[model samples]
Target: MDSQLHIFFFPYMAHSHMMPAIEMAKLFASRGCKASIVSTPANAPHIHKAIESGTNLGLEIGVLSIRFPTQEVGLPEGCENANSLTSLEMMNKFFTAVNMLDQPLEQLLMEHRPSCLVADLFFPWATDVSAKFGIPRLVFHGFSFFALCALASLLRHEPHKQVSSDSEPFVIPNLPDEIKITRNQLPDYMKEETEFSGFLKKLDESELNSYGIIVNSYYELEPAYADHYRNVLGMKAWHVGPTFLCNEEKEGYKAVRGQEASISEQECSNWLDSKKSNSVIYVCFGSLANFVDSQLMEIAMGLEASGKQFIWVVKKGKHEEGVKEEWLPEGFEKRMEGKGLIVRGWAPQLLILQHQAVGAFVTHCGWNSTLESVCAGVPMVTWPVSAEQFYNEKLVTQVLGIGVGVGAKKWARLTGDSVNREAIEKAVNLIMEGKEAEEMRSRSKALGVMASRAVQEGGSSYEDLTALIEDLRLQRHCCGSK
Candidate 1:
């Protein structure tokens, strides 16, 4: 059963989900294992480009393209990934399109008969598909332990339902610490039982039934939560990440990561060269965040007022004229001049965070961005827009003390919450200046060191990864791969 070992990764059709899985696959490949990432045609290019370096180094990493039934589900063609989604309503259709991949993926399971399948949280069906072929399935959510623990508590306790108002804070019962959250801050699906809520219930059952979960987290970052996840909640998990760092050794590797057509890493790096160490702030929302024009204007004004060196990567949209630059203050770019760099499309995020000039990050608290900043030792002004970002905000500002929240009191997939200029300025200043800021920086640097240690020999993540690969090898032998 252990003959010619191979593993397959099927991540949700989002860059955040796919890239980490790619890195995880690379880690397996580097350890003399063969791995393949399964993706649709539209999303396979990203997987192909990301794995190029590892593949060139003679690692047996490859892409296994799967067909997504786009036309049947009524989503626009080429809408294989969530980044291409324009609205929340379209997301349902896109997922329906994704769900349609079950048959094709099942066929692959039958044909490949891989040792294990590491599937995304979105694909609860994979548990059964892999079981059909006697293959183990591990869940990858691209999140931290704290977020998962807190979410588990929320779903189990229903504390938010007991609260009187959206703003009324309720203690998330049975966590490692006392954490309070409001109804508004939770995902819209969690606020009440919806069609999606039913789906999440299925996801939870599948997770419990799967072989184990894979997290892009380290033991040191949230020791209490990690322990609680395994011990108290009774879940099997391996924290083998910040997975993106697995193969960052190659020269000019940053450019290939999260690559887009515009704004090369060299261009971004040259701009950072002029600034002093820990002087400039890097601002970026994750790909799915769509801020209304007013919110975008507020961000521009807030950054301008902060009087700090900054780089803002604007998320490109489908609008012909692009959601009105009139949202920007008049002559704003001219006024800021050399002090500010605004990249209209993709910016090399990992490269920018690792640079010497980056003091703080004003981030939307996406798990990848949060972990990237943590790895870089950059403190954050946590502006959580959607998903489990609010839970991550709590982890940073409350548990870790490496970030300050920007008073983002609401959550929506397409965020229209316009936090005032003052709140943004205050959070930025707190993360960048004063004794508190210095202390936060010191703490962040220490955590960054821990992150580095986690990936090195004898580290927790290193051991977990080794143990996981070996366990898969053993499982293949014992279970008898069909």
Candidate 2:
């Protein structure tokens, strides 16, 4: 194995995607492989921090900056990531800007001629670019094997299409787990034909043609789905994940953008120290999730009614002005002053979750957050919003038995019926005080221990990563000999 083997990573502009990819790059660097991450200028700052941490450990990880075509795509300056966008129409423009990078990305690949290129699944054309240089392209889906299997099964069977109404629940066929999902719970693109559907179809085709797929999940978490993906899908794949946990000892390894904890470590610790062990609930949606006023009010009321100590993250949004005055119940903050803490921008999620005071999580079921919860040994009250999240909910509650859903049957918007205070209260109570909560807590702790062990020396995820690096080194030697 040559120390000169270079692996380049290209993550999508979103925080959820970029965070894991950056961690993957760091892991490669720690193993003495020359690693680099490609990003737009706006995203470069976040990557720089991670690279700097690796450098301190005597690992060489570089950041390659490509200009994001903001003006060309009609996006405002600094509107690079998905969280900056305001509307669905703006998302198309963001993709347009991302696709414009193809030319620049190709030029970089030609110049560097890295041993392998790891790219996000959204870029279907990356396979062609890698082929031009004869480099292997590993598509990083940034999700678990279970969600991937469920989505693939849904697309193949089209079970949602067979249902008459959006509320009708149907069992997904040909899966290792018996999972039930309603039509409305499906991604919007699957519900009706949209532009995203076309993009997803193309992405799926490119995945089959690419070198192999890399997932941010471990074998112990979902062995059945991982095996199904290999035997049934016939795809070359590797499961080296809970990537964030790989570099726990490295200081300054925080999430890019909105994931950083707003409260100081000392301050957060002081607050958590006041609560009893496993007595507090932590609530946060991912960076991109935005809720309507009605929904926000319901969540606030529900948390209040649960009569538990909690920490909730409320992100800033266009329609979020005057939320305290208009959306919340009268004197809500005053009433719950000592009982809860509301973080406005970013919450130190990893630190908070690892604290002994934290008991459960109310999450949107995003892959990164879900994995973090699993690693921290916290039970979850699932409330999936969009984009394969409902599938993830099934994995958490039905398969793993570490969570319970909030009875959100559909992806709600400002116009839809809010999940209501009653449902949120019930879910919170179930995870906090009910008899089932104890079983969930025990299972969560067991999974957490396995997750930690999997990333250590001689563990499943550790071996998979070692195999991946060695495979690349062998490929480089074989190619150079020619």
Per-model TM-score on C-alpha atoms: 0.97, 0.95
Specify the highest-lDDT model's number. Answer: 1
lDDT of 2 by residue, 104-134 (tens): 9999999999999999998889999999988
Give lDDT: candidate 1, residue 463: 97
**What is the C-alpha lDDT profile of model 1 across 322-417, one tens digit per residue?**
454666798998998889998877888888999999999999899999999999999999989888999999999999999999999988876735
lDDT against the true structure, each candidate: 0.87, 0.85
Candidate 1's error at 101, in angstroms?
A: 1.4
- Mark the regions of model 1 whose C-alpha exceeds 4 Å error after superposition: 54-56, 317-324
Q: Positional deviation of 77 in candidate 1, in angstroms?
A: 1.9
TM-score leader? 1
